[model samples]
Structures are given as structure tokens and as C-alpha cells.
Target: MPATAPSASSAALPTLLRLRDETFDPANPGAYNLYLLASPGRLCLAVADVERRKFVALEEYQLTTGGVPALAEQHDFLSLRGWNAVRLAVTGRAFTLLPSPLFRAGDELAALRLHHTPTPTETVRHTTHPGLELVNVFAADAALADWLTATYGATGRMLHHTSALLAGIVNQRGAASPRRLYLNPGPQELTLVVLGQHLEYCNVFACTTAEDVVYYTILVMQELGLDPEQDEVTVWGELMPDSAVFSLLRTYIRNVRFGFRPGNVQYSYRLNDVFEYRYFDLLSLHFA
Candidate 1:
């Protein structure tokens, strides 16, 4: 049977987690920071807490490509007849991970699964605090030129998945939507950062090498209508602590005499500090 969208009362909120490389390592004992992306059907029930850290328990289910039994048969460890809330990391297609009210407290520690009907599509996943809406943007006519002009504006471009996700989050939060978005596939890859609403100007440039940072920084300044030599620009993203990309981007801006600040970006309500929280906050928000 095709899965129907859940009612308001039963809808699942979205959740976002900014995962650091260390968090993925089993050797690390510290609990990883996680934000609830869009809202979920159930609230988390705390089982333990220590040293300002939370150890909460909630029902969790895994969805696969087939029906529940078929999924169970393929995975021997999964319990086909009961419910389970096991720590999990989901990978692969995002659309397959639809919200469902199939889990409940007191159900046994068994695997439960569901599936979505087949359809031709492209998957765009944006991680934010739980409960934030998920928006998917695709080339309307399958032409980069048309997509760019329609979503961001002339000379606008999209170079990273993070920018697109940010645009979607802002629009979902009632912010202005961009008219055109641009993307280029080349060594001198260019990504245009644009504020959807009518702003003073548009930023442009190509990050060919570390030295190209100054050129890019100047472009951003020109777009914001700020004096590159006098004003400062706030930049945020997930890059290695000591990465060539980060150094290049930072040095380029610094040399231009613009005030440069480094910080993590958040896209949800539960954001606190540091890590770039991208997914929807599920604990407090809901999807229509």
C-alpha cells in the first residue's frame, strides 16, 4: 500500500545533526551533539542524565526498499514482529526515509520497516533541527542556465550542497526565495551566494587556488555594496580544522583588509553554539 501523509497529530518532526569526523569514530567517548530535524511523531523519553549530558531513549525503526517482512528476511538481526529504538545512522536515498507512526513505547527490540512507492526522482537532503520543513530544488527544465536564472538571478551560481540547503531552509522559514541559482562544473568552480530578496548587489567569483580567496572576498563585498577594504564579512561552513580550503578562504579575505570571522552556521531552532547545525529541528516544529 502507498504510504499516506500522517495527520497533524501524528506527524513526525525533522531532526538535524552536525557530525564531526571525530564523532563518527568509535574511540571517542563523548556523546555527539545532535539537533532534532523536523518534528517526529513521539517525544524523547529520558532514561538517564549525567554531567549535564542527556541519555534519552526513543523508539526507532529502519525502513528499507521492500515491505517489512521482506526487509526482515534480508537482514537476519532485525526482529520482524516487534519495535526497537536502536542508535542508527541512515545513509543513501533521503526520500526513502519518510516519516511514519509505526513505532511505539513498550514494543520489543525488533526491527520494523516501511517503503515508499517507486517514482522517477532526484534526492536532495538538507539536515536541520528536527521539525523544520524539507524542501527539494531541482532544475525545472534540466538546463543549468535555466535553473540558475530562474532560482537565483543572472550570474548567480550554486557550488555546494550546503548553499542550496540554506536557501531552502530560509524560504521554508518564510524568508524570500531566490529567482535563480547557478552551478558550474569545472576546475575553476564558482558558487554564487545570493540573498533571495532584492538586495543591493550580487556576489560572484571563482576559487581556483588559495590566492583566489581575495578575488572571491572582493566579489562578496561588491555584491553587498560594502567597501571590501573597510567592512567585514562573516563566513561559516564545515571544513577540516587545518584544511587548505579553509586556510585559502581565510587568508584571501584577511589580505583584502576585510574583517573576517569564523563560525558555524545553524539552520534550526535548537541551535546552541559551535557546530554548523544544518538539518530541521524536529522537537519543536512541524511540517504542513
Candidate 2:
């Protein structure tokens, strides 16, 4: 129940979701590995037993407001709650990828332009995963980057939300249906990833209603030559089973199912009480 900054900002937004283990001891920070995820509408942190690969604690706060302006403030407030050594991942939509061979460290913003037109003041950065054979190029506001570094001591592994989503999907690919569509929906944005032999397609769409969700999803299905009546579509992020988005998706796609936790990792029973699909990006940070 304790928080880092119980300011008017925290009071205004309120904590929308929270889950943690009774075994967690804030005093022994070094006993677990910490992961932090900051998004436009949510801020989250989790602790896991590195060796056992089990999540020990998890927390999420929903911002009444959205976008980069509120991230630093919410993050500073979350920091006061409790955390040890940490890994920070920013989950905004402004990110693109370049093959590792073509990536130039100082020109992340330029590389991002291959796909996006970043704002003038956005802080551009890149992280390479040699195994994935691609460098994730992303942008965040300068102030948010500075605050994260000052508080977490310079993040060595900066992940875009897509990186975690891909990692999670790849880890579960073996058990997944032969063809699948994975959707991670945020406040007013949805990230769609189509997986098969390789990543067939991946893109983010700005959406506001259940109708918009169905339109984009079906559009991608058509572009990929997928049959909505047969192909399975697994969803995660902001929507729930009974939510409008999920219901609408089910109406169009016959095999609509919620995603499961990363198949390759172990998790504590505490995490089982919540829907595994909810924090696929945050928990998958272990694999990223």
C-alpha cells in the first residue's frame, strides 16, 4: 500500500491494476530482478527470482491522462513504492527495426525514419538482440530518458513494447496454432503481429472503438490471405474477455482466444490469479 510519490498526480489517475506475492520483501532488493515498463496510459514494475524464473511481485498504475508528458511523473511516483536493481522498457508506439548489419549507433533517429517521422525533441535510442538479428530503434522524450537514467542508473537494455511482444510470441510459437494473429491493445492504439514461418507482418494502429479494432484486424487478415473463420487470433494487453474489443474480435474471427504467459518461463501462483494475457509485454521482459 506504500508509494514513492503520493502526490496530486497519483491521486488524479489512481491505480487501475495491481498484483503481488505475499513473500515479497522490499528490504531485500537484491534478492530479485526488477523490470519496469512505462507506457502512455500505464506504468508497471515486476520482480522475479532470476534462478527460479518465477515472478515474485507485480504492479501497474493507469494514468487518467496519456502520452509522454505523464510518464516521468508516474515513474517517479512508482519508484517510491519499491524496487531494487531495475531494467527499464518504454512502451510508446514510436519504434521501428533495422537489421543488425545496417544499424548505426548514432543514427537511430535516422533509421527510425525508414518507418516513422519522430518529433524534433524525442530522444532516440537503439538496442540490439544478436539472436533476433535486428536492432530495435525507438524514441522517447528527453526528460523521461533522463529521469530513468538518473533513477535506474542508465538502462543497458532499452526495449520497445514490440520487442517484448515478439519475444513472448516466439517463445510460445511451438504450442500456438499453425497460423496466428496476436494483438496488444493499449488506450487508443493496437499493435498487431502476425506469426507463422517468420513474422508475416507487424504494425501499430491508432484505434478508438470496438469497430475500429475489427476493421484493422480484418484488414490485416485480408492482407495476409488469412481466413478469419479458421485462423486463430490471440489477444492481450488492455482488453478483457468480456470487453467490447474482445467481443467484436470474436464476432469476426472464429478462434479468438486470450494469450497465455510465455511458455518458456516459470511463474509463481500469485501471477496465475490474474489473466496471463494482461502483462505479456511486461513479464516477457525476462526474455527480451
Give the candidate number with the greatest TM-score. Answer: 2
Q: Lowest-scoring 10 consecutive residues by lDDT in candidate 1?
A: 38-47
| Model 2 stretches with alpha carbons more than 4 Å out | 1-13, 64-85, 154-156, 175-177
RMSD of 2: 3.8
Candidate 1 residues lying further than 4 Å off, grouped into runs, are 1-137, 140-190, 194-208, 212-214, 252-288
lDDT of 2 by residue, 1-288 (tens): 443334455455556655566666555565667877887766777778766677877777664554433544654334432344466778666888777898777888678887778787778888776656878898876666766666556433466878878887887777545867889887688889987766768788899999999999999999999899988888888787789888888888999888887776777677776888888888878777
TM-score of each: 0.29, 0.84
Candidate 1: C-alpha RMSD to true structure equals 17.6
Winning candidate number (lDDT): 2
Over 1-288, each residue of candidate 1 has an lDDT whose tens digit, in order, gives: 111222242233221222122112222223222211111121111111123333221112233333222332432222211111211111112222112243233321121112222223322222222332322222111232233334334322222232233333343433444332221111243333333343222222445564565465556556556553444343333234365655665554442211111122222222333333212222111121
